[model samples]
Structures are given as C-alpha cells and as structure tokens.
Target: MTFLTLLLQTPAAGGGFLQFLFPVAIGLVLYFFMIRPQQRKTAEAKSFRESLVKGTRVVTIGGLHGLLVEVGPETVLLEVERGQRLRFDRNAVARVAGNPAAEGATPTPNA
Candidate 1:
C-alpha cells in the first residue's frame, strides 16, 4: 500500500544515520576498553625498564629470574645462577620482584 511505502521511505534515512554511528561507537568503545588500557600498560612497562637498577631482582618476559647486575642504556646484565650471567634487552624485563620500594608492600601471612 502507499502508506506502507511512505513509512518505509522515511525510516531509511534514519536507519542509515544509525548505521553510520555504529562503527564510530564501536571504535570508541574499543579505544576505551581495549586500546587505552594497552597504551597505559605499555607506558608503565617502559618507565619500569628505564628505572631499572643494579642489584634488583627481576623476572624476564621469557620467565628467567635473576638479580640485575648492571643496567645499561639498552641492555641489562643479569646473574641467573651462581657464577653464571646473561645479557638481555631492557624491555625483556617484565616485573621487578625485589625492588626496595616495593618490598614490604604486602604483609606475609603468619603460618
């Protein structure tokens, strides 16, 4: 009928506008929920790498745990075992396990 056709025509432009907004809304949601968090974590990791110091205990991205013997501009010297050392990029360090400032941050359970 003519009335049905007229109603459908009017809704088409409005539906198109909604469709245009959808991808934009998805982009924003992805940015906030996924992209923003990753950026912040990367910033944190970079700062931690820059602040690394000798004599600190750290874990690497490859699961090697060691004492930081030297902190270079782009590399670190780690003592992984008795009389054995290894070299790695600064970014290879994942988290500091024995930072003096982070020590005692959590209370140990009394057994």
Candidate 2:
C-alpha cells in the first residue's frame, strides 16, 4: 500500500516543473516568431515613407500606381494617368519605384 502511494506521488511531483515552464516556453516562441519580425517590418515601412520625394513613382496599398507630383505632411498628389491626378494619405503609399539604376534589372520570380 505504501509503495503504491509513493509511485503515484512521484509523477505528480514531476509534472509541477513542466507546468511552470510551459507558459514561459510559449512566450519565447511567440516573441521570436511573431513579435520581432512584425516590429522590423513596421520600421522598414516607416523609413520608406519618410524618404518619399517628388518625381518618384510609387504604388499604393490599394494597387494604384502613379508618379508623385506633390507631397504634403498629410497627403500626396499622384498622377495615375497621363492627364488625371488623385490624392491619398501619405501612409497609403506602399512602395516607391526603383530609381534609374534599377530600371533594367529584372526581378526573379519567387519559388
């Protein structure tokens, strides 16, 4: 009878350490896989936005492609067509088109 009580109590005692570590291991995994990469992406996007200037072509998040004709603190004037223009919030811009040095380079398709 005493041996049976001792054997059962040993497994319960071992589980206490695993229970304490489970949340910690989950937190570390989340920080590495989710939180850190998102922060890096946000910083890169912010820097790209701050570097905008006139005469640069850009694509908006909504898939609009245009040349930047004018820029303001809160808005940008875009020439989407030969004679048409549109206005959008600065943050709506997605990525700037590459400069002349990159014009001839072809992008490799992703696997």
Candidate 3:
C-alpha cells in the first residue's frame, strides 16, 4: 500500500531532528505565552489577599463593594451598607477598592 511505502521512507539526514523539535518547541512556546503568565498573576493575587487588614475597603466577586469589618484565617466580614454586613470566603474578595494604583497603573477618566 502507498501508506506502507511512505512510512518506510527514510527521513533526510539533515532535517531528521525536526520531527522531534517541533512538539518540544510548541510546548515551550505555550508555557512561556500562557502558563507562565497565569502563574505570575496567581502569585500576585495570593500576595494581595494575604496583605488584607481590617478597615481596608474591597470589592467581592459578586460586585458588592464594602469595607472589611473583620479578617479571619479563611474568611472575612464585609460591611456593604450601613449596618449591613456579610461574611465571605477570603477568595471571594476580588480586589481591594478605591486605589487603582495598588493593582496596576491606569489612566483616569475625565468629563
């Protein structure tokens, strides 16, 4: 069969390594472009979460903005409105609020 003949053909001596090179090269590219950046961002988020203290304002994953009333080992109490407090997992704190510079520099809007 034609398929059997093609499979038995000898690779060119100079380019024989290309077959092995391509998949390894693609894997390296994927790690640098995708996996590495995600790991760095995750580490930054962990650092941000660990630095929290009482009285710091933050936004939750649910978009509820509040000041932190209490911080625990794995949870926090956030006061959303006057006399309205809700407990949330520490991971639910998306990011600290009111200081965009703390997360990253961004241009401010003007009207």
Off by over 4 Å in 2: 1-11, 98-111
Per-residue lDDT for 1-111 in model 3, tens only? 999998789675666589889999999999999999999999999998999999998999999988899999999999987789999999999987886344456546761
Q: Name the candidate that leads on TM-score.
A: 3
Candidate 3, residue 1: how far the Cα is off, in Å:
16
What overall lDDT, based on C-alpha atoms, would model 3 receive against the true structure? 0.90
Q: Write the per-residue lDDT of candidate 1 for residues 1-111, one digit (tens) a residue.
A: 999988888744457778899999999999999999999998988888888999989999999888999999999999987858999999899997765565558856972
TM-score of 1: 0.71
Q: Each candidate's lDDT (Cα)? A: 0.88, 0.89, 0.90
Candidate 3 Cα misplacement greater than 4 A, ranges: 1-14, 99-111
The TM-scores, one per candidate, come to: 0.71, 0.73, 0.76
Cand. 2 TM to true fold? 0.73
Error of 3 at 32 (Å): 0.3
Question: Per-residue error at 92 for model 3, in Å?
Answer: 0.3
Worst 10 residues of 1 by lDDT: 98-107
